[model samples]
Target: MPPITPRKPQRRALLIGICYKHTHQDDWPELLLTHRDVDRFRALLRSRYDYADDEITVMKDDEAVPSRLWPTAQNIRRELDRLVRGTAAGDQLVLLFCGHSDQLDTEETKDKTEEDGQDEVIIACDAKRIVDNELKYRLVTSLHAGVNLTVRVLSLS
Candidate 1:
């Protein structure tokens, strides 16, 4: 009798791109190519990485899409939680962020003992910030053993 091989595990991805157009701040210039970069990366995931449309979640701020897909701090956290909520071992997860980022001074951050005395944050569409500690708690610390996680951050600022 022939041996039976195990099936491949599921793959999921969350892609976020924010242009901050609605911020209306003179200092925050709009990123002209953020959305395009997200779209291209999404295409690559679908074609090269074998990720299905349903398995990938995209949040962009350039279009008049639903508020749920606006890449706000709340929505980003919600989607990230959803992405990591239910998964067995061997599952593969990918998170891609393309937009502006900033470093908050130690006094402004909850973790004051940072090596650089600053907390890194990703800027959301509503001008909110998602700190690195929050992301680590949601994505890294919550993952189960044998699960694979990939994170890519492309800062436009």
Candidate 2:
């Protein structure tokens, strides 16, 4: 008789990317890579699936109006928790992050290292680099500590 192995459950996907522009000439390598990677991933998930505009949240870097803390990483984590704690079982939940992935371990800023930090930090219209760590993953321990929902990350730049 063949032994049976348990299969991991799957959830819905939430995709986020920050491309276009980031740094200057000296930082071209990282910047260029980030853009290409983000573009590739965005095109992947957004193809063939007809999802409502709200279902798919997009945060892009614009010279005019970029995303701040509220609508950036905070929004992403909030949405993830809402789904995990809500009665949406059997329903898929996916979280996709695209950009430059870095390790933020400095005590001063280590606590808050989401996609918005170091990765998608852009010169917003208000001139602020969004911090990702502010999101309350502590209240909902099931997230960054490898909790509920499916997380997919792709880096082009």
Candidate 3:
């Protein structure tokens, strides 16, 4: 009788790029190359990492894509949830963000873990901020055992 071979692990990715083009705030000016960065990263993942098109979820602010694909706080959270929804040991997950990020006062967030009293955040296209604590909870702590996660942040600001 032939022995059974082990199944290959599934690899999934979520890529986000926000330009904040419509934002009126002077502090949050429009970014020129975030969308292009996402495109190049996606291509790299496809070519080098063997990621299928359907395995990657891309969210960009400067594109005329579907509303669900927009880089809003809600959409980002939803996609993150989806990325880690179903999986077992050996699954690989990648999260890539290219856009603006800022540090907020911990007084506003009421999170005491920040030693500097500042909470790092990634700004969404709609000017919403996702704090580092929230990200750690969602992406780091929620993963199953042996699930490999790689996170890359390309902050222009």
Q: Which candidate is the best by TM-score?
A: 3
Put the candidates in lDDT order, highest first: 3, 1, 2
**Which segments of model 3 are wrong by more than 4 Å?**
1-7
Number of backbone collisions per candidate: 0, 13, 0
- Rank by TM-score (best first): 3, 1, 2
> How much does each candidate deviate from the true structure in C-alpha RMSD?
3.4, 9.2, 2.6
Query: Which window of 10 residues has the lowest lDDT sum in candidate 2?
Result: 119-128
Best by lDDT: 3
Q: What TM value does model 3 have?
A: 0.92
Per residue, candidate 2 scores C-alpha lDDT tens digits across 1-157 of 9998645543344455554354333332333343355445556656755444455544444444344422244554554555565333244555565554433334546645344344333222122334344333422344433444555656432
Query: Residue by residue across 1-157, what tens digits does model 3's lDDT show?
Result: 8997867888999999888887677888999888899999999999998889999999997558688999989999999989988776899999999989999999999989899999999998888999999999889889889999999999965
Q: Candidate 1, 5: how far from true, in Å?
A: 13
Output the worst ten-in-a-row residue range by lDDT, candidate 1. Answer: 20-29
For candidate 3, the per-residue lDDT at 4 reads: 78
In lDDT terms, how accurate is model 2? 0.45
TM-score of each: 0.91, 0.46, 0.92
